[model samples]
Target: MISALTIENYRGFKNFSMNKVKRINLIVGGNNIGKTSVLEAIMLIISKGDPQTIWKIISGRGEIVNYVGIPQGVIQPEISVRHLFHGHEVKLGSAFKISAIMTQANKSIDVDFKIIEAKQVDQILYASLPSEGMDTFGPKIALSITRSDKKNPLLLSIPLSSQGTLKQNTLQTLVNINFQQFPNEDERAVFQYIPTTSLTGQELISMWNAVALTAEEKRVVEALQSLDDNIEQVAAISSPVIFPQFGQKTGFIVKMRDLEKPVPIGSLGEGTWRMLVLAIALVKSKDAILLIDEIDIGLHFRALSSMWEMIVAASNRLNVQVFATTHNNDCIKSLAMLKESEISIQRIESFDGPAIYYSADEIRVAATRNIEVR
Candidate 1:
């Protein structure tokens, strides 16, 4: 799991840091407070220096520049991650290059790069850099695209801001999965990002059907049902992946035990669909990092606490590290309830300038005082 992350000069954030992270990290902030930017920074770091991968991370979800085009000044988007790579503690940071020539603005942004040894295990993390003086902090070579007969560049490319180098196909597949595994046909056509290794068609159905409905699932479902008396019982579907039927306008599928039939998931209610998505995401994201933006979306305030209980269980059971963002006070309260030795909460708050993080205890205090740091 990544214990810490830092990002600089990316979108709304000048600098952001999260430290002392646990298995499950929750980010809470108001709109435009750079909550999603943190996730984008992580995706960029993991993708290495691939141009296409960088574009995917920055362009989607309205992160890209608008009609005015790319920003003129320095584009020093940097990200750092502290995690166990191959069971050894390591820190990785990546920076991208931006030129002054993009606009008439005096963007004398000479890139710098360097590498150095660190003193702490998960702290004081830095990336390995080339020998070139200050310009070795990231990849020495900046990527750019040029037409066959043109002398100048056609597109200025910002390389992947990941820790180390990764294969193009490997990085693409990872990005595809990060966005979502259940992209519709049209979504796939634009950017499929799906790996051939991922389960498909009947394979997905078979896997869901074969799931034993373990004790953990039972516990989770019971907790979910407790939130709503209307819910009779929640059961896993054994046939056909339960997903949004795009053309039908239903956001999910529900298999009711009474009728013993599949029904439109939207008819059930938003809370049910949210729980089901979390459940499926937990199961599918084993041994991987799951990034959830605005996790409180479409969730009922009363059910927020129960949803977090299941989230904690999923993280523990699946070896998955969850990084979710929320602006809801109830959501933060639910996270505060999770204070075991194994589970922890890290609250990221953005102030006037840099973003700071608080541990589980600090967050509790802040929440108690009715502070609005985000």
Candidate 2:
């Protein structure tokens, strides 16, 4: 678990540090106060500066722009890196660094991102260039990623198109290479990120398949039962219809105790789907880290306590560290009920100021005193 997190020159933060981070930390703040950016920073560090993760973070925010390919007419999407920095503009020496101190190891993991001008010494970094234009690979700009645990830094030359953006294909190739080198999933830590909109049907099906026949599946079913006691079993199945637009081509269906026929999980309501997704994600993230944005979404206020209860129980059993953001006071107060779980509340004032962290005792005091933690 990360005991402390420090961000420098990252999105919306010039220099920020938050200490006393517990196993389950809830981040609260006003709109555009960089609540989600904190999650992104943690994702980057946990990924060990993987280019694929960087592409996902930037592209998810619609920061990509279209450019004509090397073969001339074909269009390709390029991820803009400027938005990732503090000033939202990329200069010759722009950089950002994120570091965290692990409580178990008592050591820090660091991920640094820097923009440097490409030189002759950087020619060896052009291993994943486009096939057609191998000779014209003289890029003026390059993004250098350095990790504390890694001996050598990853240098990716930025293509000279629309403010020197990174090509999606380039990052994908790097990701493939990384996967080939590290093929086994158990060799690395599991990292799962749930967004405000929750997991899509395809994502949910894939996650369910990961824990389908294992003991984790039972936990998922129990989580759903918290919302609806009638939920007896859950399974992911392929739809008879071929097209997804017409209907869900593949999704989860639930067997109810009262009903004879299996019903689509979506038919039950958004709360059930949300609970199912959360449970599956938690199970899949055993012995790892789970980052959730807007965790209180798609659920009634009545179910907030149950949701936190399930989260606390699963995270404790699985040894998973969870960092979630929320604006709901009920969701914040619910943490006080789970006394056994190590909880922390991080409140962000603004980009110009530091974040305030409250310990488990402080959280209980705030809840008892009816203080506005949000």
Best-fitting candidate, scored by lDDT: 2
What value does the lDDT take at residue 91 in candidate 2? Answer: 69
lDDT of each: 0.47, 0.80
Runs of candidate 2 with Cα error greater than 4 angstroms are 67-75, 121-128, 131-139, 153-162, 175-189, 238-250
lDDT score, candidate 1: 0.47
Candidate 2 per-residue C-alpha lDDT over 139-189 given as tens digits, one digit per residue, 9 for 90 to 100? 466777878865555534443222657776666665565565334544544
Clash pairs, candidate 1, are: 45-161, 45-162, 49-160, 113-134, 113-135, 113-136, 113-137, 114-136, 114-137
TM-score per model over all chains? 0.56, 0.90
Candidate 2 whole-model C-alpha lDDT, 0 to 1: 0.80
lDDT of 1 at 206: 36
Q: In candidate 1, what are the lDDT values of residues 279-346, reduced to their tens digit?
A: 65566566666777778766787778778888787778778777787778888776666664444444
Candidate 1's TM-score: 0.56
